[model samples]
Target: MARQLDLVDFIVGLPMPVAASPQANPLDLLPRRPKAWERMVAHVPAEDVRISISTTWTRVVVEQLREDGCGDQLRANGSIVSHDVPPGLIWPEPCRLILMTATSAARIHKRWCLEEAPGTGLTNTFRFARQQHADRAAVSQQLRLLGEGQS
Candidate 1:
């Protein structure tokens, strides 16, 4: 039997799929940069250190489970769904809905310039940070070596 969806089952204004059909390339879902991207990049230093962290969105189900004697208590559970996870699987709860979204990879990448591991990549920000932490002398040595077109 089909279960009737309640008000709590709805996630208001959830985004529509990027394409008309499931067979469409998933990359179509990737967020696009704004027209001001270059101007925005100009403000961010090229030498700035960048990192990627928890960048997945999730949804949860919360229910008010009433015990025999105790007052109503909420039991909550959730699953991350922003990745390439297959959808339409049965959630244990009837009214599973997205309560909040976590940081997304597109948002993170838009905010920070992600590059390959520092020294080998186009930027040496991490190497600079490491050297700075090690000693001022180490930084000077690195700068001198780089000045000589070595490192």
Candidate 2:
């Protein structure tokens, strides 16, 4: 006859590793911030434009111009400004705005296209739509270009 094991018996038979000290706080599991992030935060203004680049991609963030409804005016003028930003990317130093050329915008669009997965149809479509908005911003003289060092 075969030997059948109960729940407690099976659990007892399983190998267990030695236990370490428990964490005092859950936040202790979070990774430490990089030195670059500290430097950038110290130098950059909250209201300025910032571009963060990584090994695989780049991200642009434009802070909302709250004083005198300037952000609203910019939006009314068809500017491409976004206040919503995802965390994790470290922003560079604050920069002055420079007019973005259509050529440059096109290059940016091409880069996004290359980076996006071709298999993700819906995601690709959404990204393409965003690229079109950027292209429109370039045409409307509302797109701003960041220098290489700023990124």
Candidate 3:
């Protein structure tokens, strides 16, 4: 028959150019930078850290759902055309939209940047990753040296 869509998700998926589409969601400005995107990065409780969505426009979806009053038209002859990227929409960053007409669902994955993670004192995520790599290298070197010396 026809597919169903949630208004919230539909609104969130709309592209920029579409007149009926959603706004330029500030969430894409995740983890802010230069103190400009600070507000978007949220402080998850008891985590000692912050989290944000991607700034990259990887996941962007177009709307195909048409509403005539309270009901929405889901399928175009029970085919996938019911889920199309509302024509003439373009996002600033690179993005991809996936429409699975069989399920009538749209999924988006976009890129983003963060402001700071220092608020929780565990903001050294990158530093920690680098340090771990260095430490592993040192350990590997030590093990190789010990093996060579013993052999």
Candidate 4:
């Protein structure tokens, strides 16, 4: 004689659902915007760096560097400075300003990581670095041409 099936037995007898297939196109998986508090950084040769905080729509300066509980802190004068840039905020001079999320200073504890842009954002570390390098090279070339003309 067949035995009555218990709840656990019935559940165990059910077929498992098939896992969804991965997307065929990579672009379809891209995020709409960067996650909040994503870290971004830029290394500039200038004595002071200007940052435009998108959230507050204000500009701040990083005149010096400090090590603190928040890892590497950029300071203006004596106070620690931090900036926040929301998604879709087009910095007037994106080439000159380095934008980051506020928590970039408070949370992430790596000095090198603090100097990198968020993996996904309006601008990324690789692109920003390349642009800065290109800009410097262009200026150098222009200067050389002017010197040659004068000679």
Top TM-score prediction, candidate number: 4
TM-score of each model, in listed order: 0.19, 0.17, 0.16, 0.20
- Poorest 10 consecutive residues by lDDT, candidate 4: 105-114
lDDT of candidates 1 onward, in order: 0.28, 0.30, 0.26, 0.32
Model 1 TM-score (2 dp) = 0.19
In order of lDDT, best first, we have: 4, 2, 1, 3
Error of 4 at 130 (Å): 6.7
Pairs clashing in candidate 2? none
Tell me the spans in candidate 3 whose CA falls farther than 4 Å from its real position.
5-134
Off by over 4 Å in 1: 1-38, 42-134
Weakest 10 consecutive residues of candidate 3 by summed lDDT = 102-111
Candidate 4 positional error at 29, Å = 36
Q: Using lDDT, give the best candidate's number.
A: 4
**What CA RMSD would you report for each candidate?**
26.5, 16.3, 27.3, 17.1
Total clashes in model 2, counting residue pairs 3 or more apart in sequence or in different chains: 0
The residue pairs in collision within model 4 are none
